[model samples]
Target chain A: MLQNVPTRQTIEAAHMLIAPYIHRTPVLTSAFLNNLSGTNLYFKPENLQKIGAFKARGGLNAILSLTKEQLRNGVTTHSSGNHAQAIAFAAAKVGAKAYIVMPENSPQVKISAVKDYGAEIIFCMNTPEERERNVQEVIARTGATFIHPFNNYEVIAGQATAAAELISDAGVRLDAIFAPVGGGGLLSGTGLSAHYFSPGTRVYAGEPEGAADAVLSFRSGKIERAPYVKTIADGLLTYLGDKTLPLIREHVADIFTVSDTEIIAAMQYLWERMKLVVEPSGAVALAALLKNREAFTGKNVGIILSGGNVDLARLPFGKEV
Target chain B: MLQNVPTRQTIEAAHMLIAPYIHRTPVLTSAFLNNLSGTNLYFKPENLQKIGAFKARGGLNAILSLTKEQLRNGVTTHSSGNHAQAIAFAAAKVGAKAYIVMPENSPQVKISAVKDYGAEIIFCMNTPEERERNVQEVIARTGATFIHPFNNYEVIAGQATAAAELISDAGVRLDAIFAPVGGGGLLSGTGLSAHYFSPGTRVYAGEPEGAADAVLSFRSGKIERAPYVKTIADGLLTYLGDKTLPLIREHVADIFTVSDTEIIAAMQYLWERMKLVVEPSGAVALAALLKNREAFTGKNVGIILSGGNVDLARLPFGKEV
Candidate 1:
């Protein structure tokens, strides 16, 4: 079992356990982008992961860790987005009942996906307190285990495997790896992957300026609220947790904040040049690297494209469909 | 040098010759897509090709075949799309001058890409007749050789390599291979590849109902024009040439026509389910397969996603930016 924070052995074991359930997502490159940014960029496209996000990794790991008896009681999680789908998908895969607490305002596509996975949906008022309260009710009623979206050790260990694969597959001694910081699950997990697998490589983070909690937490050495939250990178609007913050503080070298415009431009370049369908949050790490290109000119950098769940009806780039 | 129709040896040789330049693009698959359509689907994403199209293969092969004596005068072609960019890019790579005749109303994105490649663009009226006239004028003035977009044997051989790569890369024996027909460059090449390499795999084509000339030609046993040319699948508008027509006629088993609505739906499925940024023309093959899903149930099918070069300002599924 993983402790408060995952160790190298736990993470490796988690990777081996979850190997059949997840894709060893390829590391993509664009020479045109490398030239435009003046740095060799390696993209680990988790956008192509099952359920269109790396949340699938954590969701699968956490669910898979449950005892068969516990799994029969079902699993519960509160997310109106990717984590909802991830939990629903993972639970169904293991023949466990899944009760998902979602905001009433969750997008139709997300709701449809969760429904398709045979998870019971418990809609709540669109607030953290309301969602958690609803999840507690589900737990009380069904004895469903509440899986934390990011703060759990088993989940973090699973997320770490993506970075581990990149380290092995990129075919270069990556100088640094970058990932978008939301609740710090992927970033901290990525940081630990570097710590254990490639000690020489540093891990940095990209946080949206609109929802810049991770940077504040990094400096203050504790979980902190964002000054404001108004970014198009909606997947990155949460604060880091106790378990995630400490790991990030210890393992992450720095945090760079980028504007929504910068993120959109990076996404456009990815769509046009690389023919990749990446969302705003997915493009944030590349945006941050491009913004600070001078600091690491000609260096090899690995970026984890976090997800691809853009609302086609309301694309960020143009007028609504 | 190989003559008229490319044999297995010539296609193999073309693959070897262009190995240094073109991407041996990966064959992608989606289990969700397979379940929905009731068929095992393998996608050859030529959209991730060098110039974002398989045209790069044909252009590079055709240009490389030109001797120094012929190349000094430069090469000319008439296209307002991927072929134009491919010719320019290939010519620029080999230090040869390229004169491209494009439609006066060519999309800004296409114009910018050609300009970026250092090609001399001569804009003509948006008609095949006018474009050919301008190509002739450029050739007469500069003594450059005119490279027909699809008619030339070398270009067909180049296009064939993408299908050949798919046959090699897609582990299971494919029951059928599908591609959209435009000038028939890629479809004919794909047909030849199947004929030589995977003899059991039947070749089929998807044509947009709006630009339904290829099916007309296949039935009539001659070159024929579409009754009307209007579809979001802009890449499949052109009719087949003499060389491509004969090859397609002999090798292809059937042709299926899909409506614009079907094409758009298939494109959306690819974007949402597969996380692939494919253009409407690129999605046409899958559209045809889905429309005729009964005929292909439980069969392993290969679809060549032809390109991913949509103008973001004018996406097919949404309101104009």
Candidate 2:
């Protein structure tokens, strides 16, 4: 059951499991950007990955890692959107039933995508407790295995595969890597990769101002939770999980908080210059670089664009229903 | 003066001027899409090109084609946004001064980017005649070479080079290719490349219903003037220039029209499903495919994703500024 998983081994196994299903999305280095930031900037384009995000890698890896009996039992999860879609897609590919618990407030575009994949949708109030309870109920009713959205060793190890791919593809020793922190799955995975592949490399978590629990946690050297998150970056609203917070603290170099305005501006820059439509959460790493130019300047900075599963209608100010 | 004018030789020559300055963006093929459409689909990702559009090729080519004496005198252009920014970026790279005339109605994000690259900006009421007159005045005052945004052979030829790169990169013999038609710069170039490289490949121009002058003209077999354009696709609102229209007629296989709603829906699909942030104009070809799925079903189809430069704050509809 992978109950006593060593972080490094699980991550490595995840790379092998998901390699065939997930895209090895490109890492682009621009001379123009290097000149602008005085840094050798490497942009890992998870925006171009299948299902439009890095979460697909983890979701697929976790699904593939399941035993044949568990596959027949199906899987259930709760997410705002991206992770739900990823799990739904991955589960469907393996011919396993997927039960997705999403907030009623989730965008129709996301809901539609999840439904299109034939996942059973369970809508609940937009609260963590409500989502958790609904997921538990679904699991109990359907005899579906509960897949922790971002707090499981399997998920974190799966997410870490993105970093392993980046390090292998770029073939360069990076000074540091910046990743957006939500439930800390991505950060935890990235931190572990930096620990194993490039131990000397620093790992920084990019958090939105309104959802700075990760940053606060890093500063205090303890896990902290946000009362509620209110940010343009919908994906960064997740509170950290027990499985991720410890690994994040042990391996993460630091965390940087950026304003919503900075995230929007970074999104704009990527769209106009890089020809990418990265969501605000996906752009937070670049936002951190742009917001704190002095700190990231002239370094060999690796920025992981997390996801691009944004509701276009709600863009600019998040007003679309 | 580019005295040789709009000839195949002239367009071929522009390739040299812009080759070093712009990216030869890659083409992505999807077996899944091809099977669904009953046609092979090849996406020319000019969205991945420099300046996030095909304008970079034409813009850089026009600026670089300038004689040493002309460069010493500087360059001037009038555009709503993309062309102005393209010229500004190209001029900055070549150590030449840029004077750009833009409409007061141009998006602030576009203006900001142009200004950031150190261009001189002149604002005027948006009308084809007014913009041209203002550009002439700027040229007269500064003795700067006038780099016509669309009409010039240099720009058209430069735009053609993008198709050249695409054909070379994808290495697939396509039965037909689709590109958005506005000023016809892209169409002219794409037509020329098909004429030169893949003679059997038919070039189809896609335009918005709100701004479909090119389709009308192509059908009538003449240069039809557009009195006005009121479409969500800001870039495709341009009237056909005298120089580009003739080339389009000679080389184009057909012109297809799509609605603003279609363009928006296609943009949403590309961003959410394909994970690319294609602008309304860029989405036109994909829109054409989605709308007329029956015609393209099970055929080899090539589409130019012209650009990805949308400001999330100013998404054509739904998004509130």
Candidate 3:
């Protein structure tokens, strides 16, 4: 029965599997924020996690859970930045090497971060087919384990560990939780977390207005795609993966969208007022709360701050892309 | 003996006074940062405090300790920003009126925050004498007790509560601690904290190169002033106050300085890498370690993150001045 559910056991195992590699990021609460929202908001700051994101948990857990034979061969993955870095760091931690494929236009800061973790970088064409082909070729040549960034049970369970920690750390039963849905990895994990820890807790997904694939999928009761995805939250630009969608459908209660302007403004508010430096993707949950303040007022809400990996050199401040 | 000594008695009293009003901010440590610096660095995140800064401790302690007679009479003080907000918030918490004398050119965001805390704003000339005169005049007119922002014994002792909490929370004996020094409110308390909790621990004051008054004062064994102070760390603009100087002189081991560029870089590093939003003043301690990496390479060092009350609009990015 618990197989379909995200139990403390799975989260605990994921935690143990990724303990040495990933951060047990702090769950920070603010009376000031609580008073402002008329709600007790507990923020699980995964932004502070290693690789400056929660991708580390899934990436590390997946690499650690791999067979010794898989380690002997190596590991390969494709990503824009954070996932690549996460897998690279995990590979390094497990005494194995990683072959990471990336687009040429990826931020130098992210590229440098992945390189610093001793991952072999492969520049590839910025298309799904191209990335898949390159990754498959790496797997073929080196017999390396191809680690999916989000569409895998071990990865989803790994991401769920954040929610488990948040619930346990806060030591309170939350009324609801808001998590940003990218490929639905975090949502699947966080949704399962709410189901397991606080069964009555409602799990809502925050999506970028321009990239509301999760929202469409949840409302239609089927996997749906955003027409030509475009958002400043680069991490949330992906279409839902096959493994993530099914789990998300079973657990996610609702989904909401926030504007790009709202995202930046929310980021600024967190930085200036709350003293939290959250990246655009991580700011989505707070942005949704700010935009739809009426819906969540006076409720006990948990917001998972997904990541903080902004390249300061290329801040989207003045000119609109 | 108590004239220049910060006893446990003062800290106890301060804790009692401010316990109900100020926040017991979290102390977050990173194995990542520890590995990078080769030091067991415990960050007492005062950035998470009520007013987004540690000044709230001193401000609340002083306000709460006021006699019934003093409360009815009101209180007056002059500050740059964070302390102003802290004092205003403290006064409001205790149902007392506050008159805060602030420089005319202070940031609008800080000014609005102080005003929002229910303090009567008094715009004064930027000169120290002018600000003091304005504060005194307000006190005379309103029969208000003068609440010196950082010079008072109550304020210094109140700030000590943070160090006490840090020691209790971290549960580790620190070899040394680096705290930012401006009016010496934090350093005085930090010095006394070392004396009370871990007497063998040394407390070092971190200052900006532009505002190296405390460094000169510590070396000369006498109170000294910077020739002319101008740094991105707006909070560290003040010279060490009379009450704090003696306490620091007796307890503090040494003082170090870092450049403005180093401060900004540290702020960026913490925000981007550590996912912390620290002001330039707060980054000085870490900057000292980064600038002189060899000196602190294998030591167990504690750094008190003084505040995160940064105005993102005016994030001192590139310009020196």
Candidate maximizing DockQ: 3
Candidate 1 lDDT, B1-321, residue by residue in tens: 224689899899988988898877888888788998899999998888988999999999999999998899999999988999999999998999999999999987889899999999999999879988998899889999888889889899999999999999999999999999999999999999999999989999999999999999999998999999899898888999888888998899999999999999999888888777889999999999999999999999999999988866566666211
On TM-score, the leading prediction is 1
Chain B TM-score for the candidates in order: 0.97, 0.92, 0.95
Q: What share of the true interface contacts does candidate 3 keep?
A: 0.62
Q: By the DockQ metric, which is better: model 1 or model 3?
A: 3
Docking class of 1: medium
Which scores better on TM-score, 2 or 3?
3
* Residue lDDT tens for model 2, A193-262: 9899888889988899899888877767667876456898988887787778778888898888888888
lDDT per residue as tens, model 1, A15-77: 988888887787888878888889899999998899999999999999999998899899999
B83-199 per-residue lDDT for model 2 (tens digits):
888899899999999999999988787888899889999999888789888988988899999888788877888888877777776667877888899989999889889888788
Per-residue C-alpha lDDT of model 3 across residues B80-111, encoded as one tens digit per residue: 67889988999999899999999999878778
Give the Cα error of residue A81 in candidate 2, in Å: 2.6
Clashes of each: 0, 9, 0
The pairs that clash in candidate 2 are: A38-A298, B37-B297, B37-B298, B38-B297, B38-B298, B38-B299, B39-B298, B39-B299, B40-B299
Question: Which order, best to worst by TM-score?
Answer: 1, 3, 2
The top-ranked prediction according to lDDT is: 1
> Cα deviation in Å at residue B302, candidate 1?
1.0
The 0-to-1 C-alpha lDDT of every candidate, in the order given, reads 0.90, 0.81, 0.83
